[model samples]
Target: MTVADLVVDCLEAEGVEYVFGLPGEELEDLLFALEDSSVTFVPTRHEQGAAFMANVHGRLTGEAGVCLATLGPGATNLITGVADAQLDKAPLVAITGQGGRERLHKESHQRLDVVHAFEPLVKWNAQLSDPAATTETVRKAFKVAEHEKPGATHVEVPEDVAGEAVDGEPLADHGPVARPAPDDEALASAVETLEGAERPLVLAGNGAVRTNAASALRSFVDATGMPVVATYMGKGAISDRDERSLMTLDSGPESAAGGAVERADCVLAIGYDIAEHDPSGWNPGGEKTVVHVDAEPAEVYADYTPEVELLADPTAALDRLADSIDSQWDAWCVDAHETVYEHATRTPDPGDTVSVSNTLPILREAMADSDVLVSDVGSHKLAIAREFPTYEPGRCVISNGLASMGIAVPGGLAADLALEDDVVVATGDGGFLMNAAELETATRLGCSFTVVVYRDGEYGVVAEHQEQHRGESVGVRFDNPDLVAFAESFGVDATRAESLDEFGDAVDATESDELSLIEVVLSDPPDRRA
Candidate 1:
């Protein structure tokens, strides 16, 4: 068998169902092999879109989502999404094709040092030079990408090498390696710290959701009677409807949840990664005692020094903590609870046209319990993170760490494929146009989803920031095309909603058989800063 055949065999052994990419000359051999394999190669309009799709797929499945690209420019285009997965902690395997090793030593056409280019972005990376190393390289890439603190990994195979015959065999599949339990001394110290505090709060981050610690997190809160708050990406780690949930922690210095942080003497940060939530904004004083629980040690930061760290699987650690702790705190943060309610019930101000405050709740209610909502990076992202109620951990997908725009459309498509759930893309006008061509991809795949475009005729987040910081907005506005017609060109039904009632009707009337777009004509000023 050829080396490319061996590579495909390894991917099959890893149980990879989809490979997203755009075709190129260097990838001919690999593409030919993929045609004969069971894994489907999803062709996208651009490598960026393909990378985004693969990135979100990994985020949802906890497996290494694979994306393929040719050498040089194609490889470079995959960098942003790959780096995003690296920083955001998503498991992804990025495969790129290179020129022959002999030509790579000289000034060869379409050849560059892909390994070093990817070194800064991946947890591990390798460029295959020998045909015999195919199976081992592929196996190592998948293993490292799916390891604890999961992130991106890269494997590059040259054109000549891919076409060469090889006798490499696929690695034997084995059951998952068992995770170690938390140390007894550390667990005891964490419990002691919690027991000593009168007002303790639980801070959930993206790691909590990635580790599937929702049930354990809920039990921990119930047993201790402590309130829980989530970071932007951490939303839905506990049901927002739960009384113990303080919705989500607002970003910036003065936040609605700041009162809870101020009143609490101790913080139990479970599966909390610093990337999703910046500690400086919330913990300016750096005085609160912290108990860090996750699959790995806490990231050392001046504002986030842990008094005790429980390094182990979050689910296992929480289960052990629940079994060891027997405590009750009757005193709750009444003010924080009130703040959460106020935010949850907030409505648009009188005479304000097209407001998220009035629109998101209707959309949330209309979606099924199993449906997924993906948020693009924009002002709406901040609002959704705070106002959207998630019943389950994977239900709400938001890009909080890298905060990349244009993720919603492709991300929703990926979520639909991975979860087999009806998906919704909530994006702003600026973000919509960033990768609007992906609409064709969605249509080609026949994946049904709803795209809600908040039409504000400007970069709303940047405009809001400029207005707040400089007392005036400039150079951030732009004219948009007739979004409805634009969407219609792609053979998708599109409509414009000018009022709350109209938007609600649009949401209610949406079907899952075809792609739909709802353009909300929003011209109102930004809501008060969080």
Candidate 2:
């Protein structure tokens, strides 16, 4: 059997069902071997897109999301996505092609220090030195990627190794992961704090979202009678339409998600990863304490040490906590939430076209059931992250902790592939430009997702900040370019969001087969986020 065959065999044994990636000459043999296995290779336009799609697949499937990139450019292109998964603690296995050992330090076009480049962003990085070690490499990479504080893992396959023949017998199937359950002592202590607290709040994050812990989260929230405030990645964890939940306010010196962390007497951060939230967001107020239950123990004090930290299955922890705690806080929180919502709904500085105040309501209306929303990073993304309500699971996706732009288009494409339903991507112009080339990706794959460009013609966040504190804009303004033509290049449809009526029609038409772009010019004066 060839070394590439062993690699595929190891992956299949590990039960990896899918890999999202772009191919390069160096990894072609491995790809060919995968053709016979149940493992499916999904093609993506850019390595970054493949990485993001893999990240999402991991989050959704509770397994490692695998992505492959070739040497040099292929590996480098996936850095943004690898960094994102690391920050949010998602399990990602990124396989890349590397130059042969004989060619190391020699002239190679698609070669760089792949290991060093990815070291900062990944939990583990290795370029297979021993072909015999491929099986073990795959095994360890999977474990570490899914280990406490999960992140990306990289294994660089040298070109020569790919073409070599394997001497060892085919590797055995991988065994199951061994995760430590919550210690009885910690569970007892966590229960004690929960049962006695006057008012409790459940703060959820990407980890919670990935663990299928929403029901557990709901049970805990119901038991405590408290409100749920999600981080960006945790948006749909509690089905925002439910009054028991509160929106993740992204503005004000502190947000509602942050306030929820502070206002409660006890904070039960179920599967919450502090990295997904601003540092200030996790600081509880005087006398208030956090009981952090997560899959990773080391993450316990990485930001702020919780009074009780339990490394256990998120859903399992929640069930145990719910059984031990009971309160009437939810009813009271409902009232508090209504007031918060009213104050929050107020309009912000008018933009070139519509006021930021009007943006949320209109968007909320536009993206209803059957519409998938993709939010970019920065002010516009922050607004959507704060205001838009996600009623269903997986209906909305965002680069919460990473806060990268250009993620929406690729992410939207993946969502389109996975979910054939209507998809809408909300992006700041700068951010959209990151993966705008994916318009061809979406078109070629016949992936239909509507793209909405919240065009401020300026870096709205930095501009507003400069205007507020510095009285001048620097490194923020851009000579507005025609976005329609950009989409047209992909042979997709395009239009501008003029009056409210025209904008409504455009959004109504977003679901059509032709990928559509609705450019909403932020011509109005910029304002600070609430």
Candidate 3:
């Protein structure tokens, strides 16, 4: 068997269903091998889109989503999405084609050091230099990528090496790496702290969702009666529908969820990553006693020193805590929840111009609880983080880490491929156009998902920040082509929604088997500042 064939075999053994990327001459052998294997190769319009597709696929399915790219420009283009996966803690295995080892001693055309370039963006990375070690190398890549604190891993295959003859089988199937249980002392200390605190709260982050601790988290909340505040990436760890859920924590101290955090004497931070929302934002004084529980140890920060660290599987830690902890509730928790509820339920003022506040609710109403919403980074992202009510884990995908703007379109495509439920992408006009070429990719792949573009004719987030800090916005405004016509150019169904009613009708009218786009014109940014 060829080295390319062996790589494909390893992927199939790892249960990889799809590989996303733009084909190149360097990847010719690998692509042909994938065509013959059970794993389908998805050709994207851009390498970044391919990486994003793999990123979301990994986030949703806990498996290491695979992506391929040629060396030089192709590898460089994959950097942002791969870095997004790393920072967001999504499992992804990235393969890049490299020039032959013969030309490594001297400078050559399109021969950048891809392995070195990817070092900062991956948990582990290596070149496939020895064909004899192909099986072990591939297995190690998948293992490291899928391990606790999952992130991206890289395997670079030289063009000449990919065509080399190999005669080995993939490593024996070893299921998922088992996570360690919480220590007795740590567990006891956590229980003691929670039982003693008058105001204890749970702060769920992306790790909670990544570790599948949502069910255990709910049970713990049910037993403890403590309010839960989720980070943007942690939405639906405890359903927003739950009375104990204080919704997502916004940027400032005045946010309703932030208020809950401020009032919390003890915070049971389950699978919480400091990167999601910096501890200083919520625990400004570093006074709140933190009980950190996750598969990995807590990151060291001045504002986030854990009183007790339960370095174990989040699911197991939560399950144990649920059984040991006593009910702990405070009136302030209820007040915070009520405040969030009021804000979410508040009706928008009737007007001709559509706003994010009104637009989101209509889309939420039209979507099922199980349906997925991939939010692109922009002003709309902040609105979604604050106002959107997610009901299930992995149902609301946000790129808080790295927080790249172009993720939504390709991310929606990946979500649709990985999930049976409906997928929706919420992007601002700026983010929409970043990867808009992928609309054609989705169309060609027969992906049935909806893309909702919030048209404000500017980089709304940057403008809002500029306005907030400088009292005026500049360098953010731009004109756009007719978005409806732009989307329709890709042969996708498109419509323009001038009002909330029209947007709701458009959302309701989305077909199950067709890719569609809805352009919602917004005259003003939603008031999300706390």
Best by lDDT: 3
335-447: candidate 2 lDDT, tens digit per residue: 54564465445443333247444566666676666567877776877777776777665566777667766678877776676655777888888888877877886787777
Score every model by TM-score. Answer: 0.96, 0.88, 0.97
lDDT of each: 0.86, 0.74, 0.88
Ranking by TM-score: 3, 1, 2
Candidate 2 colliding pairs, count: 9
Model with the higher TM-score, candidate 1 or 2: 1
Superior by TM-score: candidate 1 or candidate 3: 3
Q: Put down candidate 3 lDDT per residue, 1-530, tens digits, no spaces.
A: 99999999999999999999988888889999999999999888999999999999999999989999999999999999999999999999999998889997789999999899999889999999999999999999999998998999999999899999999999976888899998999899998988888888899999889899999998888877888898999998998878888888762225877777777798889888888888898887678899999887788788999999999999999889888876657444777787786677656555645788767767787789999999999988998889888899989999998999899999999999999999999999999899999998898889999999999888877877877897777778777899999988899999998887788789889997789999998876543332
* Ranked candidates (lDDT, high to low): 3, 1, 2
RMSD of 2: 3.8
TM-score between candidate 2 and the true structure: 0.88
- Total backbone collisions, model 1: 0
lDDT of 1: 0.86
